[model samples]
Target: MVVDDDPEIVNLVHIYLTNDGYNVIPVYNGNEALSVISHHRVDLVILDIMMPDIDGMEVCRKIRKDNVVPIIMLSAKTEDMDKIQGLMTGADDYMIKPFNPMELLARMKSLLRRFHLFTQQDGDNSSHKDDVVQINDLKINKDYHEVTYRDSLIDLTAKEFDILYLLANHPGKVYSAEDIFNLVWNEPNPSNNTVMAHISNLREKMERAAGYKMIKTVWGVGYKIDQ
Candidate 1:
């Protein structure tokens, strides 16, 4: 799905993506995009930051409230803060305006591929031993991509679950922001703030459920699951 107020940009992306054999859904505004998403199984979203009615950031936040769908944001703003804000709002990737069509296509492919793998990893429950990891009262079922705290199920987005699983799988091993981004996202050069946002979001959910701290940040190092 491509959500952009600019018809030209939407058309360009739609044309190229359609040619690449993707079923593209193009929306001119954020509301339309949300409406469509509410009823459809959208794999990914390419959203514009500036729009009429609801902007991309709000749309991203709304979607992140319940959906873990990968979102790539587009904007003319080149500032690092803009990119960080977009990531903080739950965007999987960010693209500046005047971006290369081929580059966007490449990024779309990478995001889709990684997302597919993430979802696929949850299949085949017969191999539960390799898929499920337990630390204290928290149990992570990778086959189901689910988490449970003290025998109670905890709802988590795909990205959030992946981050938790990565840390809990290693227990006490600290992982830098770059390491987490590369391992979970399968993409490089994302801002550390992006990883920080995800970690903060994940920690909030887990801590709220567990009634205690789960992830610990090592000063000047990174993060690890509390053991």
Candidate 2:
């Protein structure tokens, strides 16, 4: 799904995504996007941050409330704050306007691939090994795609869950933003702001759940779940 007030962007994205063999749904406003998402099973969403009625941020937040679908936000704003805001609202990726179609396509592919990996993990358990990770009061059940902190369920977007699992899987190992992007999205040159936003969101949710900080930010380094 592509939601943007600009028809040109929608058409451009649709063309490229379709060429890559993805079924595309284009909407010109957030409300329409919401309606479509509510009624249909959307694989992914490309949303514009600025739109008439409801806006992309609200739409992203609303979707995160119940859905773990990957969302990539498009915006004309180049400021880090704006990009971070989109990510903070639960966007899996952020792309600036006048973006290279190839780059956008790459991001879309990466997100879709990661999303499917989790979905498949939820269904396939041929290995028959219990896939669970624990850190403090937090619990991550890889096989079920479930997370809980302090015995209370914590609803995380798929990417958020993946990142947390990665950090917890290697306790005390600091993962640089670039390292995390590469590991989680399989993208080597991802933006630091994007990673920061995700880390911020993860910290907020996990900390609230455990009543203390879980992931530590290493100044001038990266993030880690200390042992």
TM-score of each: 0.89, 0.90
RMSD (Cα, Å) of model 1? 2.2
Winning model by lDDT = 2
The Cα RMSD in angstroms, rounded to one decimal, for candidate 2 relative to the true structure is 2.0
For candidate 1, write residues 111-167 as lDDT tens digits. 777666656664455777987899988999776667898889886656777789999
List per-prediction Cα lDDT, in the order shown: 0.86, 0.87
Q: What lDDT is obtained when candidate 1 is compared to the true structure?
A: 0.86
lDDT at 130, model 2:
53
Which residues of candidate 2, in runs, are more than 4 Å off? 121-130
Enumerate residue pairs that collide in model 1.
none
Q: TM-score of model 1 relative to the true fold?
A: 0.89
Instruction: Give the runs in model 1 whose Cα sits over 4 Å from its true position.
Output: 121-123, 151-157, 188-190
Which candidate gets the maximum TM-score versus the true structure? 2
